[model samples]
Target chain A: MAGERSSMSEKLRVLVVDDEALVADFIADLVEEAGHEVIGIAATREKALEYLERSAIDLAILDIRLKGRLNGIDLAQATRAREIPHMFITGSGDPSTREAAEATGPLAILQKPFSQERLVSVLSQMAQRDHSLN
Target chain B: MRILFVDDDPDTRALAIRAVTHEFPNATIREAMDLTSLDEVLQERPPEILVTDFDLRWTDGIKIFDRVKAANPLCCTVMFTGTGNEELAVRALKHGFDDYVVKGSKQLRRLAITVRSAYERNNRLRELGESRDLVLKELYHRLHNNLQLVISLLRMTEKTLGHESDRQQIADLGRRIQALSALQEEFYRSEDFRRVNFSSFLERLARNLLETSGGRIELTAELNLVELPVDLAVPLGLIANEILNATLKHASPDDRPGHLSMRLEQIAETLILRISGDGAGSGEDPDTAKTGLGMRLIQRLATQIEGEVSLEHHAAGAAWQVSVPL
Candidate 1:
């Protein structure tokens, strides 16, 4: 499945945002392995904002809770303004939190400990959409 | 229970305390004639029951009620006043006073009875609230532990990865963990924290699974409302996940968009779940099918619920049916 997706879809420049270094690195590895470039990995909303300002990122995978005051939803507002597509990969199962995250209009809100295929599938779709748009 | 009597008149406070002590022989009674005494009593130990007079020189019964509630929100309050009117009684009750009694030689006994009744009712409510909090805390703790377990297992699996087969196993395990997490979310959403709407859970599970297919598999669901307890729902949900996962895996190799249909119905004493897909076995991957882990898991889950699972192959597609006694 990885080979098929890599061959058929255009590669995307992705930014991974999560507070936990292990989770952020794991997602970064998955994004890179799925034929996408990991432009930056940020553990806080401030760092994520810095990456967004400096890089032409095609996608951002965000974790809702961050190391700092601002959470991923706040960062998503900036991504929305810049017309950058993003998705949430969160550990929160709180309905109110999910509703708030959904209000930001993400591509998907994949729960924590989600399958690699699920994330790769979303990435593949983003790549295909990017390919078609260009 | 501890009782606080607040009134400016010393004789009125004494009369009220005497009646309450006679009714509750083992009760600890305290009196407060002004703000200083009230603060001293409240700070020393908040009362479980408060009886205050409305026409006090320093404060009204309403203000006294507010103070006692601020100290202990669960404190039961009774207004024992000589200046009570119908409107004042209404206002006191609306302000969350437990009972109102006009001061008379006969009303003292009524005040004791009202206080006793209100205290009992309050005790019941407090117990209910405590139980609900305990259930929520336990659910939260269990969910945290389960998530930690899944993360630990994943980390261990990653460290031991050698071949593509191991990677596939990890992905499958992740989906199963997600199925359990979805159940936990449903439990939280449930009003009673006891039963979950299985139909809604099924629809959500199907939609999420199909979402990963990227519109390759179209889903049609005809689900009947069925609420099941946690023990029954857990295995059923896992079984549904495995069957759906297997179907999607089989359907993926087909180039054309596939149609997957799911139906859930409760008939008499049994719940019937049927799932079918037109893309079944079109380009079957012998490697994934050879493992048979999904099928084995389904059978084991069915046994746990004392249910039955049946699979059928047809010219157009394949179908799976699971029936569990309701």
Candidate 2:
């Protein structure tokens, strides 16, 4: 219990962004319970950028699917430039999505239907990563 | 030999099936489009090599290659990407991918040569891998025994020292020497080390390092998996060790997990070892240093192959770029 509490005390600030509202919510709840704040929830490229423009999100949990002439990759590339640590969340697990996801260049990929435990672990690990723009 | 030709259009398949079968009457042929059908055909009868389109409707050739490799690592794979990236074609060859041929062109005759060449290369590698697998354990043992002798000699050469710092330096040197010996082990364990999978070698090294480091952090290496001549591989390995050691030393608990990018690009007749990373704790560029042990060692290794090394501030992080003759 003490270990868990200490883990939560870090209280990382993360953004839960995906096209699927349910997935975004599910992740939002998980990261929050892990003791991190879900600073924003975004379902579209525009929404992600809007949230970025509005809030200082420490991490971005981006879905490969997004609205309007853009995709999770675009958001990922955008976030990369901003020095925001991010990972792709996907349901398809299909080749096309996997190829596109790989090209976008995230730190690591968490396949769809990943366990809450796995999701939290990835978020925690990435959240603690140094973000100084170099 | 049997060859599996995959295409959705029956006519294309018919034409290809004819083209090769007619040339080699003993050759057998089969075709597939989707993964399901491919699996079925493969189960019924397996082919020695596979010729597939890079952009199939339901499944692409890369997927086919993956499935084929899983099914039989010995099976040769050729990609007919029509007109995919020449760069991808070049890289695909680095990871045991036999060959890449552009599709539907005046290069039909060229395709014939390619098919023959890939078949020989693939079969040669397969034969080597198979024969060596039988002797892998014996090879590993012999190489280890030999290295132990070298290590003993190295220890004797170092001056006797009991200081804590001196002992620590010896330990560090011992570990690096053991890593250097892995190249010899790789030569024996693998079919040959002259043309080896640098990426796989690095992965094994990373796993070893991570285990020593208590396995707390996850280290991922994105290697393009290029193979260089033995003359190049020796120096390339040492240079890589230096950069890798630097990254591991500098990567901190608070810092993001360090990512290392190593690319060996063949520019003109020169093969370049461009190793760089986002992490740095300690490393000196010996080029300017009068006598930097680390820098001089790396410089000497590069020059052994008539290669040149330079430090550049790349977009991702700092880069150590080495270019050498092929």
Compute the TM-score of each model's chain A versus the native chain A and list the values. Answer: 0.91, 0.80
Per-residue lDDT for B214-267 in model 2, tens only? 344456455665665556566677777765554455443355555555555566
Q: Write the per-residue lDDT of candidate 1 for residues B8-41, one digit (tens) a residue.
A: 8888888888888888989988889899999999
List chain B TM-scores, each candidate: 0.62, 0.48
- Model 1 chain B, poorest ten-residue lDDT window? B282-291
Q: Best by lDDT, which number? A: 1
Best by TM-score: 1
State the interface C-alpha RMSD of candidate 2. 20.7
TM-score of chain A of 2: 0.80
Off by over 4 Å in 2: A1-134, B1-140, B148-160, B210-220, B253-259, B280-282, B285-290, B312-318
Per-model DockQ? 0.14, 0.01
Instruction: For residues A31-78, write the lDDT of model 2, one tens digit per residue.
Output: 877778877888778878887667766677887756423388888888
